[model samples]
Target chain A: MKGFLRQDGRKGIRNITAVVYLVECAHHVAREIVFPFRDQQVHLIGFPGCYPNSYAYRMVRQLCTHPNVGAALLVSLGCEGFNRAALLEEIRASGRPADAIVIQQEGGTRKTIAEGHRWIRAALEQLAATPTTEMGVSDLIIGTVCGGSDATSGITANPAVGRAFDRLIAEGAGAIFEETGELIGCEAIMAARAARPELAPELLACVDKAARYYTALGHGSFAPGNAEGGLTTQEEKSMGAYCKSGNSPIDGILKPGDVPDRGGLYLLDVVPDGEVRWGFPNISDVQEIGELIACGSHITLFTTGRGSVVGSAISPVIKICANPETYRRLSDDMDINAGKILEGEATLEEVGNEIYAKILAVAAGAQTASEALGHQECSIVYKSFEPTGPACMPA
Target chain B: MNTSSPQLLRLHEADNVLTVLSTLEPGDALHLGQTVLTVGKRLPIGHKVAARPIAAGEKICKYGVPIGSAVCAIAEGEHVHTHNIKSDYLPTFERENQHSYFQPTP
Candidate 1:
């Protein structure tokens, strides 16, 4: 595929113009502006909180300049706490078209939304004229996250995604698997799989922080559906969830907004450091997806046993159904029926290859089941992080 | 291995529990290799059943990893889930069992 080349030398599969509401007040205007342009790739994302959070600033900056995104429209409610100027400068520095609309100055909601439509259309036309460069599996970055996990997830979709990750890494592409809380008991095994021996301790310490954080919240990462699906403990779920990384050696660790400089298989550590002053590390699966995009993931593989129908704003989300029954119940939401492995209808390798092909297909502009169904779910939350440990980013 | 269509999925060879692929009723016979268990109770699909007699306080194994510890003796063919097994990580909160705020049902 000919990937859309960015000024930063990164390649992107999708050339999207992100219309981001700076705060909750401008969300309506942003949504209305993107409504008429069904033919163009315009996604709406926003930080809804009124508070000025450093985390939100970094997240919005990262999203605006993400490899998948070509340009960004900052919709400010005029007096919001977000640093709109910094974000605008970052977008402009990326050599991408950007426009800002302040609701107060632009004649309020009705007039502003009309003007935003013109700006987005002009940006879309400009992006369409942008040049694209040759891209392959090696030039792509992929991430996997398991949601609505049931018993079949570990044996089917997660392992299949892992297999895909293994193949992607072997081909010199970047692969990422996240949720440190979900990787509780597998630290030792994961550490042992680190590319270097020294990376082992850093791997262990990250999970330790996750364990402590979740313990303070009076919960493990395990959900009620997990228990019903026969997952007994957090560690047990970790063993299952860890398979999404395949058997590749860990390369480096990345906090929420850090893109991998050199990637093999990175653990996207979403857990906040220093103190757990923030509420939850991630509010939902969409937040995790958002972070993956912020870290420059081009395509995300979402494996679900209970069926998650979410597709992200910028990057494409390919849903893999892990349970046959759940697949039957929610086939419309699924892109790949990995549940076939459990039914003996398909092999794990077959599903893995299918996912790999699906990724390439999506990268080449094939709409996933979620995208085809118009499920543009995007989320971002505020959380502080004490910069990653030195070992977190391997040399 | 069962001569007929298999009813269970074993993730690991060392696992003491076999995940039921289909619901198994009492008196139904399930054969796995040389071992067999006459279902003592209804085992729902996707749920686990003890493959052998499990001692109290013994680790519950699935995917050849310790999922949790059993709180009571679980005979072969008994259901293995939250009822008897408990996680070694955070305690699975049972609101009704807490003395601080849990009120006894009248």
Candidate 2:
């Protein structure tokens, strides 16, 4: 497959120019700047917090210089606590065409929007001249997240994704699965699959931390619709969600923005390290998708039984439906009908191979159902975490 | 499609509950191990049915693991849901008493 090669040697399936708003105050202007280019590969992403956060800073920096991003235009209100200067410097260091527009310094909204338009137009031209390189399966990093889960999710889509993940890892591609808060009861089994014996405690500890954090908040990641769809308990829901990891040995633990250095299976710990300072770890599925993108996932495999129609800004999302009734009702929003396994129309291996084939097709520039429907949802919220321990990623 | 195909699926041999493959109405006959049982109420697709007689506080097994415990004694072919089961880890959320699924133990 052909891919957009960055100066840092990372390959991306999609080369997009991102317009980032450093603060909530600059969001309107950033949106207006990307409005005219919305039909193209330009997208608007931002952090809404007025206060500074280390997690948000790292996330924004990683996103601005993501392999999928060709260039970036930072929109700052000029007074927010976010370190826009450092962010711009990091993007520039990555060899991407980077520029920043401070609204306070460049007059008000009108002038700043106009300047952003000019910079983005020029950046697009430079990106058009960027070189392309041949990419292999090993160059790809795939992530999986299950949203709107039901009982069928575990029986069909989730396990199918696990099959696809195993295949990707065997072919030398990096695969990541997350939502530690949802994997409450499966920690023991998951820990047993760690690549090294020392990494077992790290895996178990993260899940234990998630259980404690959620108990403090008086909620697990269990949603109302989950119970509505025949999922009786958090652990039951977790068992289904855990199947998305496949049976691959865990390579390492990753916080939101920590990119894996090698090709293997990694678990993204979405739960914050410290006490629950932020209201919730992730407010929506889009936030998790953003975190996965920041970790260099070129494409996300989103499995759903209740039907979530969200797609990210930088990367495309392939929606696999688990329930046949839901699939029949929302077929247009779904890419693969994994419900066939339950209906006796297909086997898990067949659907898994189909998902694996779809990943290659999307990497080669095929639009997923959500992408073709113009879904570019994104979000980043306040959160904090300490760095991973030495044994978290054993060599 | 085979019209006579069993609609109830037992995911694992040790699982005490079977998943409903398609919606079944009251009085629909279900072929359990060596015995035929009739559905007493409407069971929707993806819902669970007790594979055998289960006592109160017995672990509700699915995927060969305990998802929760039975809140009340459940007969074979009975619907197993929030009304009859409780999570061992966390409380399941329901919308402002809108659904009759969960009943507080008095």
Candidate 3:
């Protein structure tokens, strides 16, 4: 498929402008800036906290320079801790035009919005002029997450997605599986699949971090809706969720904002390492999705048994329904019905092939069901993480 | 499509329970195996069914891993779920007083 060529020699499957708010106070102005251009590829993302966080800054920077993003516009409230200047420099360095407006200095909301339109117009024109190059499966980075999970998830959709992940990794594409909170059980098995057997300790430690972090929060990433769908235990749920990583040995472990330097399987440790001060890690699925995108996932394969209709801004989410019953209830929102494996109709490989093809199609500029339905869902929260040792992702 | 029919799915040979592939009523028969059993109760598609009779406190295995323990004696083909099982790691987070699911013993 044809790829959007960025100035840094990286290929992008999409070319969209991102409007980011440095803090929550500038959200209104940021929304107004992208409101008129909503029908196009404009997505709004930001840090809601007023306090400065290196993680948030780095995450925003990674997202701003994502292959799918053509340019960025930063909105500041003039007093938040987010490093707006550095962020602007990062986006510009990627050879993408970037503009910023401080609400206090830019004559407040109305004037900022008016001038924001001018900047967006110019950014879009400049993005349209970016060169196009041919891209293959190897250039793509895919991530998987299972939500609204039920028993059918492990038996059907999750494994099928796993098979698809195997195929993608075999083709030299990057694959990421996350939500250690969901992986409460099955840490040993996961560590066993580490590319370097020595990396097992770090792998186990991350899951340990999730277990402790969740224990303190009085939750385990288990939502009320999950139990309603027939998942009796967290280990059962994890066994179901774990299949999304396929059989590939994990090349390394990654934190939410750490992009994979090369292609292979990597687990994102969403839990913070420090004391439990900031609330629960990843308040919802969108936070996980946002993290996946920050780490450079061009598309996410979202499997659901109870059915969740959420697509991401900047990245497309291909919904794979694990329950036939749920698929019938929300067929329009689903891209694949893996529950057919239980109905004695389709096999796992068939569904896996379908998912792989769907990824390719989505990467080729086709909007997923959620994207077409305008489900630009996203969320990012405060998190603290200690950098990994050299063994985590050896240079 | 009105084609959601009941079927039994066994993910691993070592699994002591089979996932109820579809919503099933009691007294269903199958040519499943020599462990010859029939559905003993109504069960949801995603719920678990005993592949064999499991004694009280026996580990309930799925995906070839011990997910929980049977609180009481469970007969072959009986619907194996919350009523009969308890998570071995941590309490299964159900809508009803659901807590955390634990990590496996390292």
| Candidate 3 segments exceeding 4 Å error | B1-6, B26-41, B98-106
Off by over 4 Å in 2: B1-5, B97-106
The candidate with the higher lDDT, 1 or 2, is 2
Q: Give the runs in model 1 whose Cα sits over 4 Å from its true position.
A: B1-5, B25-27, B32-36, B93-106
List, residue by residue over A286-319, the lDDT tens digit for candidate 3: 9889899888998999999999998888888999
- Candidate topping lDDT: 2
Root-mean-square deviation of Cα positions for candidate 1 versus the true structure, in angstroms? 2.7
Lowest summed lDDT across 10 adjacent residues in model 1 chain A is found at: A222-231
Per lDDT, what order, best first? 2, 1, 3
Candidates ranked by TM-score: 2, 1, 3
Report the C-alpha displacement of residue A61, candidate 1, in angstroms. Answer: 1.2
Clashes of 2: 0
DockQ (CA atoms), all models: 0.50, 0.75, 0.50
Per-residue lDDT, model 2, residue A227, is 82
Task: Provide the TM-score of chain B versus the true chain B for each model in turn.
Answer: 0.73, 0.82, 0.71
Fnat values, one per model, are 0.48, 0.77, 0.58
The prediction achieving the highest TM-score against the true structure is 2
- Write the residue-wise lDDT of candidate 2 on A78-193 in tens digits: 99999988888899999998989999999999999899889988988899988999999999999999999988999899999999999999999999999999999889989999
Can you write out model 2's per-residue Cα lDDT over B2-105, one digit (the tens) per residue? 12237888877778998889888889888776778888878888899898999999999988889999999999888999999999988888675435535554
Task: Please give the CA lDDT of all the candidate structures.
Answer: 0.85, 0.91, 0.84
- In model 3 chain A, which range of ten residues has the least summed lDDT? A218-227
